[model samples]
Target: MRKTHLLGYAGFSGIFIFAISILLLHGRQPEISIRYDAMSYYVYGQLGWLLWAGLLGLGLGSLALAAGLWRIQKGAYARVGILCAGIWGTGLLIAAIFPTDPKGSWDQPPSTRGMIHFSAAIFAFIAITLAALFIAHAFIKDGHWKPVQKWIVPVTALTAISFILIMISIVSIFVSHGAPLYFGLTERLFFFMSLCWIGIASVGLLRSER
Candidate 1:
């Protein structure tokens, strides 16, 4: 019933939905290499609804968490961090609304919808990384979460760099006719790190209130 608890629940729900979506979709497309395929590709097949629900869950959960943070905290860092989280949530919704063009379609110039999806994906990556770093700094400045501050920097760096690599991969698609060899791996790494930071920061903030 408490606002902080709601944030924790949102964090957990986001993590759970995304994890389950990946688990269920992973083996469903054996031909698609998890190492090279984008998770968005799952939105094209028999169990596509799972990914849709998962993305919606992530978007709603992020907004809910941001709202909860806004209610419980006050400061520039907290405000900026929550605002970034909100942007990230909105990006997820945009991505869901505009799914990427199919695999073969990747070669051709992106359709209007596909370009929108790509733009949303880039926005989501940047927003979430900023959210993570800003939130981590806020917690550290609070003076009670030194432990969190310790690990957050490295995680934030990895997330940011991974995102950059992903962007490079996308650029490679336009330049040389294909994504980078490590595109999928870098993408997954970024997603997982960002999720870990969100979950940990949400729980950490909740516990700090207690």
Candidate 2:
């Protein structure tokens, strides 16, 4: 199969894995809100294989998408954008390998493994956000994907803003010794926007090749 098709499959499958995973877990975790408790499912769910498999698929699929982008596109923006996606994929892989302590276990003293998971989560968020921003810039400058660029710029901005709100909420929670407001909503917004961007870009590239 052509590389573009391969990447398209990967991109589509990555989204599928994430969607299916959440759907499967929805009934199992009645108390956990997907908006705020997605990481909990990945980190602490009893259905370990399901979560791990989903994350693995996401990691591998992201890496494949990055490779496809790098292979098809030229210029510094494309290079840097794809590099960010690659690193984000690597981070997700590592996070899957090092699952964090269970939900409500944060009060316990941090373990080395837990620290690794936390670091990986942070890295993944930063890298994915950067990837979106860089790709938006690339699309604008390249002009070949102008329609995508038009939509991407707004999506990237919203994702970044949501990410910042999440970070702020995290800090507020720690410093104030209380729950920060809208934590789950902001996190979901960030990931949803970023992932949507990835899906759209992948589809656009696939269509362009046809």
Candidate 3:
């Protein structure tokens, strides 16, 4: 297979691994409530290494997709979009490196590691949202990418909405002093939508190469 195809497959496989990891982690630890608890909680439990591996997979996958897209797309928007995607991937790596504080630790002052993880997570979310928007705009401008625009545009819009919901959920949790506001659910929604967009883009890249 060509390098582009390899990258494209890598991107998709990375996401697939992450999705499977989430499922397995959730299944293995039934005590952790997926609705209220952050996915980071898994890091403190058994098989935490799997969580780390999953996150690394996601980060690497994102980077692979960004590199693949960069090779094919040539424009200011595409360049910026690829850059944002790279930032997102880097943020994921940082988060994986520095796991979030254990559950209930939030009531007390957060540790430096926890703060770094939180910041990286926030930065990654914002960066990926920007990536989706910018890349969608690039698709609109490029006839060759027009076919992708149809799928990406709506997915980007949903991704943005999901991101907004995540922010709102986070703010509400903070304001209410950790009252459960479905923060985990909102975050998962955002992740799913963003990953779906990435998957679509990666498939488009593969098709274009063909």
Each model's Cα RMSD: 1.9, 2.2, 1.7
* Ranking of all candidate structures by their TM-score, best first: 3, 1, 2
Candidate 2 CA-lDDT value: 0.74
Instruction: Write model 2 residue lDDT over 1-210, tens digit each, in one string.
Output: 687778867977887896687557666656767555544344465565666777788888888888888876787877898899999888888888887766655456767877897788789889988888887766666544655666777888887887788788677767766444556667667767867877866765575565
User: How displaced is residue 209 in candidate 2, in Å?
Assistant: 1.7
Predicted structure with the largest TM-score when compared to the true one: 3
Instruction: Identify the leading candidate in terms of lDDT.
Output: 3
Q: All models: lDDT? A: 0.78, 0.74, 0.86
lDDT of 1 by residue, 77-149 (tens): 8789889989998898889888888865666788898899889988998899888777766766665355566
Which residue pairs come into collision in candidate 3?
A: none
For candidate 3, the lDDT comes to 0.86
Q: Taking the candidates one at a time, how many backbone clashes does each contain?
A: 0, 0, 0
